[model samples]
Target: MHDWLDEEDDALITTALELMEEQRKEQNKTAARGQRAPGAGGPQYSG
Candidate 1:
């Protein structure tokens, strides 16, 4: 766990996580609009 993070560090980490979540949501929206995802695997693995 990140229990050792102080208040400032916690705030920074939370902000970074929120930004990442926003980016993920935006990417999902783009994919829903027919754009390929960042790492578009052509097909499922059969292994």
Candidate 2:
């Protein structure tokens, strides 16, 4: 029973790690596209 529980926990951890990696990659892609226009309300400095 202990072994089974450990296996389940390992699987869940692995899945969570994979999902995080995917999200990171997606964010990098979006960032590479560059920031949105100031008028779009993305981010701007009002100097």
The best candidate in terms of lDDT: 2
The models' CA-based lDDT, in order, is: 0.65, 0.67
TM-score (C-alpha, index-matched) for candidate 2: 0.67
Inter-residue clash pairs, candidate 2: none
Q: How accurate is candidate 2 locally (lDDT)?
A: 0.67
lDDT of 1 by residue, 1-47 (tens): 65756877989999999999998777556565543453463333222
Question: What's each prediction's clash count?
Answer: 0, 0
Per-residue alpha-carbon lDDT of candidate 2 for residues 1-47, written as tens digits (9 for 90 to 100): 48999999999999999999998777655555545532343332222
- TM-score, prediction 1: 0.59
Q: Please provide TM-scores, in order, for all candidate models, with all chains considered together.
A: 0.59, 0.67
> How many steric overlaps does candidate 2 have?
0
Candidate 1 lDDT for residue 25? 78
